[model samples]
Target: MTKIIMRLQFSKTCAFSIVAFLFLFSVKAQDKPEIKIGGALRFNYNLSSWKDGQKKRGGDFGYDMFRVNAKGAYKGIQLNAEYRYYSEGFGGGMLKQGWLGYNFNERDQIQVGLTQVPFGIQQYNSHNWFFNLTYYVGLEDDHDMGIKYMHTSNRFEYQLAFFKNAEELGFGNNSEVSPNRYSYDVAGRNKEINQFNGKFVYKFGKKSASRLGVSLQYGGLYNLDTEEVGNHSAVAAHYELNKGKWNVKAQFITAAHNPENADSEDRAVVTMAAYGAPYQVAADFNMYSLGISRNIPVKLGPVSNLQFYNDFAYMEKKAAGFTDSYMNVTGVLVSAGNVYTYFDYAAGYNHSWLGGNFVDDFAKGNPNAVWEARFNINIGYYF
Candidate 1:
């Protein structure tokens, strides 16, 4: 027990040292436009029915993640960065976002480096620990080593980008046949190295500010079993309404893959973002999500407001033999400045990804426990 505590402390200390150094360096820059430093500590409590058996719940406490962000503009040249320290799931505390920007004016600019892949909805609208399904699918916070040109006006925004690393995943690894965690590359397959993405968004209404967006992605997929390269494409349409205390978000996405030699369990997939099923290649699938949130006019000690939300997603494969799945999350949050707390209940039907609990439900052809419930509570303090 002592050893575990020591190790955890060591890791956090190292991460803090790096963040402190970066902040100090930024402070030295006389032209620094804005310099801010912050991170978060989170605690999670969860209930898993199958893992702990029926009607039983178990959970553990541990580190979630810490992040530091810095952004500044000196003489029209923008410098921005956001680094993270977490359980090396995707990347090992690497630069979650690091970029250098050149602005020709306010409406146009070019950003180069590891940056966001503008696809689907810009962000997600869920209180789950892992983000929405779009993230598991490589659409949410999926950043890549690439460059992009962006244009923005009062009501229109557009972006064009090329990423060489596909999903910018697979950094810490060994040689083994396993599920590809962050990248689209199939286990024991050639990696995806080249891709292009573009997005356009239009904003309307000043009071109830609404946005509609369309995105397209074209990428190359490498086959492990056949040693060949294939093509993959995806198109998405998204719409959101953010006004007053009500927020609504919705998206429709479809993808197609043409792989040389791949089976249903192995193929090029962007990410496990929201597919609760096995991976398949040479297939067509559609995924959609709708979310709504509202803020209640109530405040208490250390709790500024009360917020409630619900999000739902449905995913289906076009192939005849493929399985379909749906997931739903309904939760409430309490927000007090930089501190937030979440209480949520999530349920899945026919979910089959990542040892999901709904595998037996498909075999029995019934919702059964697949539609059972799990409760989660997360308390976080952001600095």
Candidate 2:
């Protein structure tokens, strides 16, 4: 009788094992890996008051950039990468962003590798091709080599990150800092390192149409000449509101840099570089920006939408005898099928990339510098 009962128990155990194995196999078969590839080609036309030669020649039009993007996901693991090619004068070919991430669930995830810094604003702070003044100072749309953690929900979003440094030119312990990059960084005699960032956003209004946020950043500046570490910090408060066809954005930021430099080097300004050239930026400054845009639906041939926008930003230096900088952009974006174009009229005073010499305009700016204007058109096709 005991043997009979033991046999019955053994049969039931085998059936249970088979069922569990089949269930596990089915789950594995349902999970699939996915990948997508895409890119864009862009061209630009410009007429600048500061460029007398080009202006006399009826402006210049040429290729702007070509970029490739890739993304993939398997289970909860994700990958994203982008590479861009531009004229040698504009930094040549470089990696814009690359990251590997793992999703813990629907509301949380972590990313490792080169990723965008959570700063004053996300993605962009302006509507025009030329972003706000904060971008020139590395406070907007900056990317770094780091690990970031993100959490999202219905009412709040949070991001925390620690970056070892800006993307290095090569592997191993290399000290050479190059200006061949997409984003500006400390490049001359000093390099950015050991950075920490945190950002928080609160969402409100119907369907979360509005957001208010704050961000903080602190980082070390490693001076190769002095062989000492200095520090930099920035704080920002930002708000965005979207109601029907109208949108508005506003931000205020303050930043300071204290670098340990050789005795002969200047302390009032730090050298920042990108796009194949180095420029000097003020060591201490406060910046603010406000932008507004309105979207209108249209039907003209392939045209489907148009967005008109105006963005303005200003920077005030704290150093003695230093001048301030400001930029204003008025533009319209046209969207048609897979093609988009921007028509912008930009003006700047004592600002980099607008008129005056690129290097000193953001540093001890020329108090005598007059406002300069540029009419720009950028068109791109995406796939």
Candidate 3:
């Protein structure tokens, strides 16, 4: 009788073990895939001086800025954030970018929060991946808190966005005007602006790999004080050719005139005249750039690979409804190392149409050159 009871217990133990194994296998099958998280940090330094009239001035050396970016992705959702700190004397300070995105399908997605606008290529491209070229155009710090929709397919992709307008962030008084008063007040604080942006990307080549794209953007700032409005627009195009380790890219952009809106023409004239004649009226801005980058494998000391590249840029600005133009040129060089580290050197020169006097300089035929240089060390990991 004792032996019969032992056999029965052993049978029950075997059955329990089988059941547990099956349960564990099922859980493993149902478990979601792991999400990916990664980020990078960057620091830059700029030591530069200007030479004018046999004199050297405007020289300083300091930590320019630091930036951190983080990103994560799960099944159909993505989160990205960036923070920046500009050292003293820079025009900007601590800034932040955070956004949450959801992909409805493989070809469509929506993002909302504080984020950079998808208007220009340079604005969105990662710094580590940049070709390191000096583009003579002014960098735009345009950010908005809003929602954006993007769609991409085999042959075409497009984006549309709407956001809060924050023009007051750029307001200040000049010495030529009241010390405590604003030069212009076209829009009230805390008002929302309507922004519309669109892009069409087309691909060609046997495998549909090469691409050409054009984009347009329009924004309106409404004054809550007077119900008046200011407008801004931009049109741009880009083309890319990729083959093996060699790639070439070119782009052009034009911006509509943007003049300060004031309560009265006298105030407007004073502000515009002080700023410059070209700024008196709204004007269009133009920028064009060409870049070529190649990755060559070279074994040198502790570094196994290196990439050498160069980029050139030209830009022009014309007053609204005027034929006069100012031009600028920028050149850049990059040397990349094997450990995902790089050194970038850039040089730039600016020429104004206006002469010596502020107003006449803006009028026409005024040309002077201002040179600038920047050097930076970047370290990052990319996946």
**Cα RMSD for candidate 1?**
10.5
The list of candidate 2 runs beyond 4 A from truth reads 1-31, 171-174
- Can you write out model 3's per-residue Cα lDDT over 1-383, one digit (the tens) per residue? 77569747855764575445334433322135434444444444333333352124333334544556677655545678765555444333433567767666679877766655656563432133323221212222245566677998888877877654332244443212211111111222213356667777788886675878887877754433344555667787887766777667677788663434455432121112111112332235566766666677666665555555566655454643333333222222233442366565555443221122333222232345444444445454333
The sequence of per-residue lDDT tens digits that candidate 1 reaches over residues 1-383 is 78569748865764575445344444333354655566677777767544664234255545665667787776445678877665655333655678877765679877767778778777553544545655544556677766778899989999998766543444644332234233223333544546789999999998528999999988766665565667777899999998998888899999786666546533423222212132333246688888888998676776788889888887666655555667788898888889888888877666443235422322222334346456778888888
Better by TM-score, candidate 3 or 1 = 1
lDDT of 2 by residue, 1-383 (tens): 78569747865764575444334433332278889999999999999999989988999999999999999876556789999999999999989899977766689877878899998778898888898898888887888987788999999999998887898985445365778888878888888987999999999999899999999999989898877889999999999998999999999999999999999999999998878888999999999899999999999999999999999998999999999999999999999999999999999999889999788899999989999999999999999
Q: Which ten residues in a row have the lowest lDDT in candidate 1?
A: 269-278
Q: Which stretches of candidate 1 lie over 4 Å from their true place?
A: 1-35, 53-58, 72-76, 88-94, 125-130, 167-188, 224-227, 262-283, 352-369
Highest lDDT, which number? 2
Q: What TM value does model 1 have?
A: 0.76
> Highest TM-score: which candidate?
2
How displaced is residue 94 in candidate 2, in Å? 0.6
Candidate 1 global lDDT = 0.64
Error of 1 at 311 (Å): 0.5
